[model samples]
Target: MSSNDYPLTTFLADHSIRPIFRLPVFEDWLFWLADRTGIQALFKCAPAHYSYSPGTIRRCTRHGIHFELDISTYHGWMIYYRRSGNRRVSDLVNRGDTVMDVGANIGEVTLLCAQKTGPDGLVIAFEPNPATFAQLSKMLALNPGLNCVLVNQALGSMTGPVTMVQPDNRNPGTCTIASSTTPGKALSANIPLTTLDQYIEEHPISRLNLIKLDVEGYELNVLQGAEKTISRYRPVLVIELVDSHQKRHGHSAADIVKFVLQHDYRVTDFSGQTPFGIHDHFEDCSLDITCVPNECVSR
Candidate 1:
């Protein structure tokens, strides 16, 4: 039977594939089969048009923000952020502020941040992976002359050359410096790394309102690299603290919490906290930990 005649799950089950390979393999197969069987048309799809690159940009109805992503895994995350009802970022962004998006994979969050910050504000996005950077460049080109600066370099504790592991061509987001945790014994390439402090010093940024840190498990290192900047600017830090990814990078969730806390920023979970310092219990995974400077909130 043709792939269009059956569901994706049915095709995988009929083939008797292993569980781990079933999802990704079926997804890849379904995309191809749907194209071949004319099922793509049923989904209101056009021929795979390479407008900017191979990825798609879907606009969210809830938030009126656009997400430029390649894989389906990110779609769910975008939807969650759009419909979260907690408009902390959106609110802060409306007041004429600049944001730094570290590890901006293909500029999805970067675009969102830029849109929120508006034309007067700036968005400094950093992406290390060469392939992903190329895609990000193409995607940014679609929006002629945005106030976003795309930097093709990784952030770290120190500024110098470092090895970057690129896992799969289709999945360039998995690229990291840590070799042990990389999937499938992937080949690595050497890339230059820089610290936020150095960049700010060279570029002369007046103010930093928000900073989003999602460097796989290397959030702490990126934070360390920005110690001077953090101390000087005291911007709100939204970091992703995944325990598993931290372990691979020779760190832990507690380490991230401690580091941010040391900067006089309290961890008030995902939900906003009261002035009395009572925190809401948010599950610890990859979360948007907001670090408001003591001075910013106290005043």
Candidate 2:
């Protein structure tokens, strides 16, 4: 037997991909076969940078918004957002609406909401990582037309100094206030923390139309702290849930869904696929869920 026997599999096996192909799953078997058996080496054009720095500016072609990125890989990320749920934020936001973007992560989705909200509207964006916050500040500065107030702090159930851990240097967006028992979290910083309810009580937002949360695994805590605010405004909730991220905070998708249900809100997968009912089987909840108050939900 030689490479001519099975050129594709033999080449993939020689390059060590054969191990992945051998996984005990019919899906894996059909995956390589279902797709055309071909391989072409495309140019590796993605940028290589561990953190954002000055002099890096990207104008998103999709949304036409400028982003001074915190993560220097702007070329790839800017394109990635074109198809991701970031655009969904635009659908849920409206002109003159106020939005709170937790874990804004360099204002990726914040700018989109700002575009939908218009200049009269306001977007209060929060990012706890100091380095990332600096990039976000620069990006917002680049777009002065967008009315956004960037906050450099974590939103939780209380207001105090909180410890944030960066699980990976290459991935700054994964930083979270949740305790990381895993190793390689040598990078960390102490940042201020505040609750949405308390902040609104003092700052006094007359109308909050949306609250988009991407706080890694601290979504439940933020919700708890904003209970009063949610009850009052009942703004549309856009949340991103990752099982691994939540497990760090001792929570799960079900817990978050339960909280939303208890508050009389219904969950719709951001893509409008899954529906959360009283049955409450959230084991397969979508990564991004749009939560709407029962009163606001359309038939």
Candidate 3:
């Protein structure tokens, strides 16, 4: 079976050997084997592609964006999941609003934000992984109507070269600049990093309305780097905070919550007024937290 097959196809092919493996009275033995080795779960997590394979182009009806992805890999599964899921991010944005997508993997959400912002608005997307950035650039070509700027660099607390670790070569979403969370064995690369303050200084913007960040567990560093920008505009923030990832990266959920509180921003889910505390656990909080400044909440 080819590794380039769509996720569904690959799934069917991989499990095709199950019948042979469970011959006649060997069903119990098969079960025992699976239980002892954890073969079922690990199979999906394994490298999806062993060689270069072309990605399939698919349209996301929910957000009205097209993406090219190799469905056999984890990255493609995420794209599929994001496509079918509710578009809460789009709802938070408005026409003519300036938006930034930090850690814009493949530009799926960035395209959605661009559509919501319209031609009068601007969407700045940052993606540091070279392979993923190349794919994002290709996807952007299909949507020329969007007023967007693509930055091929990572954002952190400073402007310099940051080491990135990707345990899965085929899944660029797992590529992270946070060294503390890096797997014991992984491929490493040096990418350019810049602060949001430095970015604004170089290309000044009158206002920044919103920012959607999904940079693994390095959210604190990115936020620290954007202190000036956050203080000035107080843009609504959509950030993913995973306790496991945060711990690996030397940050905590409390740290993030405190930072938001100090900046006069309330951390809630996309549903208005539903504070994060309901699901907040210092040890296992893994959800997208929406931070809306008090000014916007009043309006």
Tens-digit lDDT string for candidate 3 (1-299): 33334453245336444333223254345435445754443233222343224453334433577766665455564554342232568788899999999988887778888999999999999999887888789888877899899999999888888778876655778788847546834443568999999999999998899999888888888999999999999899998878777777888877787788788887886566677542455578777888988777765
Quantify all predictions' global Cα lDDT against the true fold.
0.66, 0.73, 0.74
Q: Candidate 2, which segments miss by more than 4 Å at Cα?
A: 1-62, 70-84, 180-189, 284-286
lDDT of 3: 0.74
- Order the numbered candidates by lDDT, best leading: 3, 2, 1
For model 1, residues 247-277, the per-residue Cα lDDT tens digits are 7777877788778877888675555463213
Model 3 clash pairs are: none
> What local lDDT does model 2 show for residue 50?
30
Question: How many steric overlaps are in each model, in order?
Answer: 0, 0, 0
Candidates in order, TM-scores: namely 0.70, 0.77, 0.77
Worst 10 residues of 2 by lDDT: 38-47
Q: After aligning candidate 2 to the native by TM-score, how far in Å is the CA of 213 from where it should be?
A: 0.5
| Backbone clashes in model 2, listed as residue pairs | none
